[model samples]
Target: MDFDNFKTLGEWDKWKGALAKAVDLGEAIGFNENTVDKMAYRIGNFLSSTVDPENREERVLQELWKVADESDKKVLAKLIVRMVEKDSRLH
Candidate 1:
């Protein structure tokens, strides 16, 4: 589904939709209910600064590790990486 090979102009709409959904999910996660948006925003912002383009997975994991307990940090790291990778693919 490379854009260069697109037949219909609208074929790339799916990528756009997915990108928007991913970003919105990230924003909502940033606006989390329990932790307050500020806390989550800080987390989300930190992830973005350190892991944009989905590079530096270990660095991202380490940063998350410092802030979160071991079990929760592992889970959070996976979710955040997925979100980032998804964003990279779509964008």
Candidate 2:
């Protein structure tokens, strides 16, 4: 899928739902949490570099991505993964 399309998706909920579906698919495919989280970071890097932030939260993440060193970027990625997991549970 063209990850860049996410920028034009318009709504934050659409972005969140798409990400949740991806997470569900990864789990269904037997990818462990660690691998999924690693991939999430790579995806995050791609988005941060290629796509303009589509919302306030995404803009904040973009700002953080711009300033973060390599190690901290990994942390940010993990945090995002965890947030997605928590959100899925809540809804």
Candidate 3:
């Protein structure tokens, strides 16, 4: 995926779609849920540190990330993975 293009788009649906794609790709590559969740946590940390929030949802997540401890961040990342997975299953 072209992350630069995605950053420019800044739409919540696009963000969610990208996340769903990541989840799908992880599954396709035989990553277990734990592995996927860990990857998500790393990605979340990277984004929170390096990327500015472009929308309200992202801003909210950024805020949450700022206050969350390490374990809480992991839970948040897992929740994100689960959210996209469930959404993918529905569609």
lDDT of 3 by residue, 43-69 (tens): 999999999998778889999998999
TM of each candidate vs. truth: 0.28, 0.83, 0.86
Query: What TM-score does candidate 1 get on C-alpha atoms?
Result: 0.28
* Worst window of 10 by summed lDDT in candidate 1: 31-40
In model 3, where is the ten-residue run with the lowest total lDDT? Answer: 1-10
> How much is the lDDT of residue 57 in candidate 3?
84
As a whole number from 0 to 100, the lDDT of residue 17 in candidate 3 is: 83
Clashing pairs in 1: none
**Backbone clash tally (model 1):** 0
Better of 1 and 3 by TM-score: 3
Q: Model 1 RMSD to the real structure?
A: 11.4
TM-score of 2: 0.83
lDDT of 3 at 81: 91
Top-down TM-score ranking: 3, 2, 1
What local lDDT score does residue 18 receive in model 1, on the 0 to 100 scale? 51
Q: List the global CA lDDT of all models.
A: 0.50, 0.85, 0.89
